[model samples]
Target: MRKLTDFISESFIWSVGITRPKPGQERLAALYITATLAASILAAMTMFLLVLHRL
Candidate 1:
């Protein structure tokens, strides 16, 4: 959990363009965050739909 929280914080920082990220690093970090968010949302939606279908 702590590691997850740390990754999220770092991703947020990179996305916000707050810190002086190294060349190409910022884009990679931002992409990582965006992908993570998209995957999470998709997984949640799938689970919700499955539950609804089961009911």
Candidate 2:
């Protein structure tokens, strides 16, 4: 499971052209990616709910 997740993350970063982070920056990079994903999902869900409420 862990290896699969690592492979997926590596492929995503590679596809996005995000450079490999230094050893000290791994946590920060991970947090940034996670926060970005979370914020985008939250924004999409909020828009979805607002549209449904209007209808």
Clashing pairs in 2: none
**Model 1 CA deviation exceeding 4 Å by range:** 1-11, 14-24
Least well predicted 10-residue stretch by lDDT in candidate 2: 1-10
Error of 2 at 34 (Å): 0.3
* Candidate with the greatest lDDT versus the true structure: 2
TM-score of each: 0.60, 0.67
What value does the lDDT take at residue 54 in candidate 1? 100
Model 1, 1-55: lDDT tens digits are 4466447747677677666557757556556665777799999999999999999
Quote the lDDT for 15 in model 2: 83
The sequence of per-residue lDDT tens digits that candidate 2 reaches over residues 1-55 is 4454455557669889888878887666666666677688999999999999999
User: Once all C-alphas are superposed, what RMSD does model 2 give against the true structure?
Assistant: 2.8
lDDT of each: 0.71, 0.73
